[model samples]
Target: MNKVFNTRYLVHLVLAGLFSFLVFNLTYAVRPSDYDLKEGDTTSASGSDDPDVYIINEHGYKRLFLNPVIFNFYGHLGGFAKVKAISPSTRDAFITSGLFRNCEANDEKVYGLESTGEDTSILHWINTTGAQAVIDDPNFFKKVFCINNNEFNWYLKGSDYNSVNQIPVYSRDTTSTSTVRVGIIEFVPQNVVYGDVHYAYLKKTSGCWLSSGGEIGNYYWVSGSNQSIHSSDCYDILETYSFLDIFNNLSKGISKNVQRTIYGEEDTMETLHSVYYIKDFYEKEALKYGVSDLAIDIDVKGPYMLASDPPLGGRWGVGEGVCNASLTEFFVNEAISRGVDESQYDVIAYVYLGDWQLSGRSYEGFTSCATGSKSFMTVTTWRLPQEDEGVVTLAHELGHSFGASDYYTSPCPQNPTLWSCVKDPEGIPEPNKIPKYPQTKGCLMAQIIAYNKPGSDEAGDATSISNLNQAVICDATAREFGWR
Candidate 1:
């Protein structure tokens, strides 16, 4: 009896110890100290000051949360949005110089290299000295091992340097646009692949005529230093990210704004092409695909203006940068020519600045830059035409008119990552915060700008309209426009 009792007591004690250990682990796991939400399983996280919100990637469903109020803070992962400050009204101008090279005269100033590093002083010094500074040296942006999001995080940019650091100095002016201060800072992301470059800009909180996120405008450099630049770069990067974050924020925003338009909000999209134009394309393309004929509610037009006349002098993609008040009329003309009625269609055009220029069309496809007033999508005629690639390119840009995003995997000079959507074990949709649909493997839009092998014909061939490609491009576009 004594031995049995002792054994029983020992077993009870062991069980209790095991229970205690389990409870401790559960508490540690449930209590997310860094994340603010303590209620039911947190789908997303957001902080007023921190720009980088933590996304809960449970199984695959993704969610995002944001600070109730908007304000600026140093090192915010998402953005430095000023509270209650009116976001400057966005513009509807078709094209701007910085983004599209198709229309503007070649300008060297428009070209810039953004370095993702921790040291702004080093970056600034290198830019200033040009050949004199050795900023590209790998030793400069060293790494330290750390843990983030339950994984080991390797930082390429070194720890905060002892070099001079600046503080919150706001030169935000509400007066002349030129006097307003705009600054930039750079931070190495928690995860750094070889060549993934991200950029952003936002308006500061102030009672001004114009600021960031308003009509397309240039940001003037305020007093900048390593610390100041660091803050600015972080601010801009997060702001850009915030702009993108909105895509996933809404239940329907992602599906709606998949194409480009002049001034349509995410919810209420403006017309693309005239009813007639849309119907014509739909009738033609639909029959080819054996898809049901859908009535056209929107108008569409394209592939009309060549950015360059002869595709020479590195001016192959310059014609797209010429939007002003005149562009509205130009869009009207282009649409009308394509059997679009101006009354029913929203005319869109592309533009660039007179200074932006490029030599080879090697790196990427055309871009849609915006005038502070509008957005423009331009084509690079000089670069080797990707033949069938152009059709995908056109569809891709047009897709933007409907608010679709680039699902393409961005490339690096050395190593590039392919674009992939989050999926389940059975290849089903994983409910991610961002709706990542499976994209084409080697699609024209998927690959960052690679020209079609040199001598392909201009008009797209049957292979160009393959079932797989059509499903990814055309069908997706149709869905965005509500045509499907």
Candidate 2:
């Protein structure tokens, strides 16, 4: 087989649409002798096949992976084969940059080492956070640079830090759009791997293959004839996960488990593509809420609608579909039957655009984001006739799972997390009663109508969903998630 064709084919298999959905790491034969290095590659000195590996970063420098766990933390384990055998000359060609890069997957802050030329480098708080942070963005600025647990504790105790113990502050100014200069250190986007990038390690070994159902199928891919017959047996296991967990811990960056199944569509690839799409949207939602580091596990159930294409038809409301409670009853039963953990995961079930129509007017879905103690209200229709539109709708419902009340709901007694809603287009939410704000977002939970009404929100733009990364996390929601 032509390597180029294989590469292009597989690359097209995923990257044809979902960029953020898939990391898209494909490899061919390696000519280890030359310094034909790629960004995101980790290499070592040519001696004993595998010694130490350094992540090849930008600007003629490679940051060493100090330990095994740290390397795996960046998901290098998935590409262990990509570790290059570099000669001593190739090793010396790159200057050593820094030591460790550390951040929790659920954390927005990324920490890097500031060097003193000695082996020791002072740790500086990185202003950037979440999955979308570039390797390094030049424009990142902060008065409270890194908001790691340590700094967070300082604020917790209400204590003041002396100048000596304080971590060096960096002005997030860049000489160029391509390079980020914080305080004394300068680097480009390529200089660092800012956020957690996961590489899934899956291989067809001379062994059994797990079926889409997770059981070992009758077919085997170990031998030539077996490969021919068993190729499609476990193809269902080839899933694309994420996140919108590929970024929304749904809203406030906690935890989410998503299971997607295909319906009204025959193409198997649609499921994979939809997974990426959902993950991508949710991740954007997560980034909007500043929880891209949140661990969202994805489970892809193969081509079948749950409980027979849910009859998600009728007017939308909190309790039920048609001004009754049966609407909520239907989805809640399905959720319980599927063993959905209401406390942990928020689940949404959707149908093809016209599948659940009632009249000239399409049927709507029941929603309950933060209504009393209701844990799940699955369906969300309206503004979801198209595929992309449906994803945003489902994500909106999922946000309820994160405990974000719809901005269209209450007015008085106010939501303390966001800016005062007195100027709200929908209605005025009272001023936030929270004592102080460390970080805040555009109150994105506001309904579309709120932003589109004939007035400006003195609070901020609440409906900038199209403007990615234009949102942030508010203080109370951040406090609820324990980020404060």
Best by lDDT: 2
**Candidate 1 segments exceeding 4 Å error:** 1-291, 295-341, 346-366, 369-375, 380-389, 409-471, 474-484
Q: CA lDDT, every prediction?
A: 0.24, 0.32
**Alpha carbon lDDT of residue 434, candidate 2?**
47
Against the true structure, what is each candidate's TM-score? 0.22, 0.32
List model 2 lDDT by residue over 1-484, tens digit each. 0011111212212322211121111111122234687766777776644366766644444555544544555552365676777775465445443222223234544354443432233454433232223211211221112122432332212122111112222211111111100010011111111121121122332443333332222211111112322344333222323222332232322111222232322111101122323444333233222222332344332122343433444334433423234544654565455554433322333222222332232333344332222323232121211122333444444344444445443332345454323234222221332422211224344423233222333453333232112222333333332222
- For residue 458, give model 2's deviation from the true position in Å: 11
Q: Given candidate 1, what's the lDDT at residue 470?
A: 31
lDDT of 1 by residue, 1-484 (tens): 0000011212212322221100011000222233332221322112222222222221111111222221122124334332111111100000000000111233221111112422121111111122211121111111111112211111122232111111011111111211101111011111211111123232342443224343322232211112232354233432122211221122211111122122542222111121122223333333222222222232223334333322221232544433344444443344455554333322232322111223323323223433322234433221111222222343334334433434332232122332232112111111121332322222222322222221223322113321112323233333333322
**Global CA lDDT computed for model 2:** 0.32
Candidate 2 residues lying further than 4 Å off, grouped into runs, are 1-293, 300-314, 317-325, 334-362, 367-389, 407-441, 447-470
Q: What TM-score does structure 2 among the candidates reach?
A: 0.32
Clashes of each: 65, 10
